[model samples]
Target chain A: MSKLSARSEDYLKAILRLQDQKKVVRVKDLAQLLGVRSPTVVGVVSGLKEGGLVDQEHYGYISLTPEGKVVAETLLQNEELLRTFFEEVLNLDSGEATQNACNVEHFITPRCRERLVSFIRFLEICGRGAPKWLDHFRHFSLTGEPPPCDRCGEIFPGDRRGCEKA
Target chain B: MSKLSARSEDYLKAILRLQDQKKVVRVKDLAQLLGVRSPTVVGVVSGLKEGGLVDQEHYGYISLTPEGKVVAETLLQNEELLRTFFEEVLNLDSGEATQNACNVEHFITPRCRERLVSFIRFLEICGRGAPKWLDHFRHFSLTGEPPPCDRCGEIFPGDRRGCEKA
Candidate 1:
């Protein structure tokens, strides 16, 4: 885990995504997805095979080994979790959140990942499958005002504050 | 931003932290901080100088240029934000969260960073400078149980679910 480079992790995750998309992951497919040359993909695939994380036949489809499946699935789950966090919790655009989530999946430590999973569960099951503040945030984003009035505890449109004397 | 590698970002951040610690950043200091050899640091420092990111006197102290200062400060702030999110928001240990924050700072895009900053601010000011769920989570962790009985909202130890018919 410590020795894996970000590049390799990206490659692995890319392969997993391509597979999910019903694409047979070949060197050319990897190259297109990763924006690298086919030769580079071939080299990295060879390295992945040597590490026993991937299995490839001669000029054939690339597939994850059993051990590789565990790693790839965990990475995919991490990316999905982060994407949800960014898009649902943070109110980011879907496309931008997905891209950022992919990059973040490689760097997050296991402990942080566990904490996030628990937090996400807590958020989902706590009341209405979302926090109260999340609704307030959505309102604030649309109105460019604070969530409710601080003094009166009422949602406002930024112009009316009941307690102006304070 | 797209052209920068994770390694170079790490080097820039290391220099910034060392500088903040009031240490004279020479090639040797960078090498020690980065766990790389001195010659590797020298090579990267030369590249940084060529890019006008760092200014180095001949065999003397290394310092960031204005452009470099901006980049380094942004990275440091991103790291700090993430650390706070993990530690304050997620209740992770300080040392582990700080280390994870360092790795996360490099991969987060500007858009995501902005969202995170806003989210952290929201968490800080939402109710009592922390979300209501955070207290529930702390209690849950201490007792190794869910936050209160589902039916009555009463805190309980594990195995004490009041609703057995559901």
Candidate 2:
């Protein structure tokens, strides 16, 4: 598949979100959701239509093609995974996690995204009720000092760059 | 700071990388690095110059302004952090990690980047010489069955979506 620009992907995602919430999508709704002018939405939607990712009525409602739906779902899945990682693991506020996830979603490749999914699952399992590193990360974020690793003799702040070698 | 398009950020990063390796940045070099035509590089560089992010000596050599250098460094740092995470923690091949990191760097916010840095440090300290989850992730990638998390009773493939609750 050809790579779409990040902005174009954002448009696809917004269209999907608007459709889900309102059960219909229009140029005005897309513009409002994306915080852009109506003309910009019109232009991008027309481009998406030409690319066979969307369909539109005669100057009316917009809808995703099957291909577009797949693209939107993938983007949404990535955003959700990242948001969950940031909020649950990193302990970021929900708003910050949502914003960061939105910003970062377009960049993750399918291959990398698969690994991320598995990694998230790993964390979920390991983090349930044991000596979870997720909590350790949250503590480090709060106190700028990472908890010591008994496995490795190197202290975190003291070793700093040398930690990479460990 | 005004937001630049992903394209613009890519251009800035390309120029910085070319300058670091070749000691000079020309339109052709940028075209080759970005896999775009010289005309595209010229157009983008012109916009960069207009935006006060770059300086071109009579349409010959291109160099970044001080402001542009700051932007480039931030992008570079994000890429490095991601590349290291992918390669070191996730065990992706170096080339794949670098490529994915380049694609994803511009989207990470500064605050998120700081957390990532700390997270990497935490992993380095905790993962060394131990039954590290980093190695466990590589195992999951290969076997497709995640190593069990004794704390949670959820098995990965069987409880795909429900793993989140675990």
Candidate 1 residue lDDT tens string, B1-166? 3355777888999999889897678788889989999999999888888888999988889999899989989878889999999998778899989988988888777878877777766554443322344677565544545555452222211222344421
Per-residue lDDT of A50-148 in model 1, one digit per residue for the tens? 888889999799988887777888778899999998888878899988988888888888888888877766555443321344666565555545564
Global lDDT scores for all candidate models: 0.73, 0.76
* Model 1 segments more than 4 A misplaced: A1-3, A129-131, A141-144, A149-166, B1-3, B129-131, B141-146, B149-166
Interface-residue RMSD per candidate? 8.0, 8.1
**Poorest 10 consecutive residues of model 1 chain A by lDDT?**
A151-160
Top TM-score model: 1
Off by over 4 Å in 2: A1-4, A148-166, B1-3, B50-53, B65-67, B148-166
Candidate 1 scores an fnat of: 0.24
The whole-model C-alpha lDDT of candidate 2 against the native structure comes to 0.76
